[model samples]
Target: MTGDFTARVTALLMPHLILAPIALPMLTAGLMLLLREERQRTKVAMNVVSTFLGLVVAVLLLVQAKQPGVQTSLGVYLPGNWPAPFGIVLALDRLSAMMLVLASTVALATVLFSAARWHKAGVHFHPLFQFQLMGLSGAFLTADLFNLFVFFEIMLAASYGLLLHGSGRPRVAAGLHYIAINLAASSLFLIGVSMLYGITGTLNMADLARGIAGIDPSDRGLLHAGAGILAVAFLIKAAVWPLNFWLVPAYSAATAPVGALFALMTKVGVYSILRLWTLMFSSGAGDSAQFGSQWIVGAGLVTMCFGALGMLGSQRLGHLAGYAAILSSGTLLAALGFGQNLLTAGLLYYLLGSTLAVSAMFLLTDLIERWRNDGASLAPHEQTDDAPFLAADLVHTQGLNLDEKEEVLIGQVIPAAVAFLGLAFLACTLVIAGLPPLPGFVGKFAMIHALLNPLGLGSSGGFVLGSGGWALLALMVGTGLLALIALTRAGIRHFWASHDRAAPKLLVLEGLPIALLLTGCALLAWQAGAVMRYTQATADALHAPGTYVQAVMSARPVPNSPGTAPGANGRPQ
Candidate 1:
């Protein structure tokens, strides 16, 4: 009987696995709170198992999302069984599922990486980590504005603890700044959400889209005001320049695993803009159609340029990674503004590859810096380090060091750890720099192709590019070049400038996450064809807002259990 009960429970829960990505971590985190501090091993085990299970569920959802057809592929789960617009709804579609997979993948890898030593830095690390995942999952899956705010707060709240996980004066300072900025943003979030709800009777995103389309012309100004305020909150989170001063210091100060996972935080902002803008302002939205497209595109271009310049100005690996992330956000935001379906597809592809590369870069920075610290350090202008920096040092090439330096030009043995880090760094640089022969290059190429040849990819109609097209093309290439130069400069400084290099002690746990992230980048590049097809479909679905609305708005509440009348308990007749 017990076995039968267990089997039945499993069967029952299987259908609700759509909610598992969000709910699993919440339950796991709650259960973990009961454990004693001395049982850190158990906490770690629970954290890892829960994260791995979340990854499995994410992959399962991705498979379902990939199945062809709108109604079939778009999975909607009403938590309260009260239908959309009336109660909480969780959505699983191509876009949200992809984000779930990405979040879970990063979460599992970072948890494993932290297991090496980082998680021990602070109290409640395990629970905070799980809560962070829960927030990320919910933000992606939530089908309404209010729940998005709740999840955003959940994410930011947990990040507050994670940011200061390994506390130092610098970390505390940066974390405080991060918290203050986000808190302000959250206030704006609440105000905007409230305005939206007040203006329209519902906070459901799908219903909001439907309402916005038929909204009176006089209220358009108020509507735009609320959305603009909401966009500011997202832009702040996305680290759009001038508003991004806090990001580098905070992220750089985070522990390695935390820093890596924090890479997804900015993307959540980008994802929100993508979901709402596409749904609420599509071609079918009448007057609101493409309303803020120009402004977003302009913001994106400026952000891209600012990020590239910031990268060039950055002197450290952590700073470089932070700026690289900002650059990615700009690129994605800019692509979304272009209002082309094929461009959107390429942007999604780029988003995945760039996210992997940036996350790996964050992890790599800690390892490389640790290794550099273990090595003998010399001032760049100091007489001993001339060969690595001076063009004269390049011209004065000699088989023997002029001073018989410790670094031998003739077959110096590199530690396996050093070699591994170097290769990973190289991969990250290529992808983040958007260089050739990788998905980074392929994704951009696809975007440019779609831009120059809209008809090439089956777009519904063409829009005039004016001077925007030329400017975007120029910026795309220009930023890539700037990124390449900046990363290459940093690479030489870290890997080549020093004499008597040493490798830090590395654990499998520490190394595995970086390796897996880099490997994922490679896989994306290798499977670009299949990946693009999937992204193309996603882009197509995103451009078609009506389908999304129909799916969500048409959903009816689950029926009452047997013996209950249809109209019982105030149920709709």
Candidate 2:
């Protein structure tokens, strides 16, 4: 009887795995909200368990997406058995599955880290966190543009709450700016969606793609205008330059765990751009083929330069990590603008590595800052002014103690907490700087290789790298170098120069998550070949979106025959 019950439950769930990623988080968030605010332990347990289940579901979906001989690369789910272009649809493809797993993994880590302390810093943290996951998962899975907007709003709202979780003066100030900017972006998102719906008369992404082919020539200009508006909103959220001034300050001021989660937020914009551009604006898109390619490339290059400069100028670790996120976004955008499948594969890999690295850096920064005399603030103040004198005084006070220096000192022993932090910091530095033996290096190298060997560009079957390619190559290398210099300097100051300071108290929960994140990156590096192959497959699928469109449209339930319509009970004959 128990075996029968287990089999029945598995059968019931087999078809709905696509919805599990989004639904689980939403349900958990609702449950947490219903619980009393003081039920912190219960909330934490529920959040962790939900996130773990989400991660497992995401992994299963990813594996299913990569299965060979599949009719469609995407698995589509329709609620209430509604037909396409009418009812809501959830679709999971390699790209969406990959994103789901990444988001879930990061969410788990952030939640665990927060459980150590940040959750108690405010009420509703767990619910907001779950809601944020719901938003992210829903955004990735939705097959309709309107649903995308809904999920985007959900994500933005949850983010606003999380950003203000700890409630300091700086956090409040930054949170307000973050809220205002996103609200404006949301308004633009609505305008763009309305315009697209007005032109196409449909909000389903697959349907919109099909409709674009039949759009009147007279309406083409309006379609482009709407897409352009939508792209602007995405670019803002992606932190494309001039418009991204709020990112550094907001991310830096946010609490550690909140900042870690914010790392995934920018990627949402990048993901949206990649999805819509490939689906609705590919070479198959008549009259709109590769629209705004040059603009994206130009903007991406400028963003990269700006981000590199920001990293160089940043004094605090938090600010550096924020700028690094922007740099990663710029790199991915530029790669997409190049319209190369090989580059896209590399970009996806890099996206995963960089997001994890940046998130880990946020948590590590908080841990390291606890031991600093000035705490986490990077502002120039009196303590900074007296730094040189303090160094000199310390040297005179301790280094020249001849009376007590009769015995020679042996090797200096490091504390467990300090050693762990130092090692984790080193891993983060290598990953962020794209150094060798890490996934960061592997991804960047793949991108540079693709750029150098452009396919079918010359009579010899290989093309010389363009001026733009060379410029990008130089920018990537220079950016990595700058990151190394900056991080190395910071590491020495925090760990070596300040060795005399007491080690920061690290909790098991906090340290475990950080270690796991870095370890995951290392494992990715070790299995780079298999991971790249999967990413390359995802890139191929993205570039050719017919499978995605077909899967979604075909998943819609068939209508009844002309003579066999709905009966009095509304049941189909």
Candidate 3:
């Protein structure tokens, strides 16, 4: 009887699983808002449980998406049982599922890390965090453009709260600029969406793709203009080139865990570009096909160059992490612009690895800086200890006793805490620099190999790298070198030069997240073959958007001239 009951419950809940990732967090955030700020413990507990549930659901969704058959693997949930192109729908395919999982993983880590101290730094941190997760999950899963704007607003608003959580001068100042910039971007977003709706009757992504081919000739220019404006908004959010100036200060000033969470925000923009570009602007887009490809590629390359220069020039670790995010975004954008599905598969892998590395670095930066300032002495230290004695001092010391002269220090001993920090820092450096034996390296190698050999295995055709491809190759290697130099300099300054400082007390809560993140990168490296296959499959699905369109549109009943056919739950059939 118990077994039968369990089976029945599973059957009942199975149909609604697609909504869990978004709904769970929204409900948790609402519950958290109801609680008083004094209920800190309760809020933390709720936050953890909600994020964990989200992670579990995302994993389950990913598994479902990776099933043997295409239609069976994709999951589409229509609220109120309403048909598509009319009512809201949430679609989960391979790409969306993968994004859901990645976002959840980062959200879980940030939440865990924040519980150590950041939660207490503000009154509504937990609620804001959950709301941010809701926004991110919703953005990933929503099938309509208007809802994407809604989710983007949710995400930006939550981020604004979280950015000002600690309330320092730098944080507030940066927050103001961040808010202003994003508000402008939001305005442009609305304008573009309006224009898009004006050109195309529907906001549903699949439906928009279906209608683009039949759009009137006069409106084609407007559609392209709308798309250009939309791309500008996304590119700014993605931290591409001059539009990204606000990123460094805002991200650097944010609290550590919030900063880590911000690492995923840029990817949200990149994901939007990928999803929309591939779906609505592919070869089947008629006059709109491959629109702005050259502009995207050019902007991405320029963004990468700027990011690399920023990393090289940045002195603070926080600032460096911000630039690292810019660099990662640029790389992914460039890959997308290339329009090679295989290369995009590798970029997906790169995106996952880079995001994990950047988050780990953000957390690690806080811990290191905290240690650097803790119990620091006010007295001025002797800077000339290693310098040769002055002539007067040398003469006096020589006359007194040659043996009594102060001896110069040989080497500094590495402390246990510093050693641990050094090792973790080294791992971060390797991952960010795309060094050997790490997932970063694997991803970059795959991209380069794909560029050099576009035909894949068993193909006899020869290929030549385009100028853009060569530029990409050079920038990839150059950025890695630049990162290596910057990170190495930071490690030495923090760990080696300051070796005499008291060892930092490592908290399990603080260290555990960083360790887990790096371990995840390592696991990705270990399972590269399998993960690459999955990413390739995702790439294939993205390139062929028709399958996705069919899956989503087919689920809805054909509408009559007046309205959709009447169906169950008052929804049109």
Which number leads on TM-score?
1
lDDT of 1 by residue, 146-262 (tens): 999999999999999999997899999999999999999999998888888878878999999898878888888898889889998998998887788899999999998998999
lDDT for 6 in candidate 1 is: 98
Q: What is the TM-score of each candidate against the true structure?
A: 0.91, 0.90, 0.90
Q: Write the per-residue lDDT of candidate 3 for residues 409-448, one digit (tens) a residue.
A: 4433556766777788899899899998998899999889
The better-scoring model by lDDT among 1 and 2 is: 1
Cα lDDT tens digits, model 2, 1-573, are: 999999999766666788788789899999888999989899999999999999999999888778874435337776646757887878878899899989988988999999999899988999999999999999998989899999999999999999998888999999999999998888888898899999999999998887787889999999999998999999999999888999999999998999999999999999999999888987688888778877887788888888888888888999989998998888888777776678788899999999999999999988988867534323345347676566557656666432243322443467899899999999999988999899889999988988877673321221245766787788789888888888888888888763435556789999988987897899889999999999988888887788878777776454555776442111110
Candidate 1 collision pairs: none
Residue pairs clashing, model 3: 565-573
Best to worst by lDDT, what's the order? 1, 3, 2
User: Which 10 successive residues of model 1 have the least lDDT summed?
Assistant: 564-573
Question: What lDDT score belongs to each candidate, Candidate 1 first?
Answer: 0.86, 0.84, 0.85
Clashes of 2: 0
Give the least accurate 10-residue stretch of model 3, judged by summed lDDT. 564-573
- Model 3: residues >4 Å from true position, as ranges? 70-74, 376-415, 457-464, 557-573
Clashing pairs in 2: none
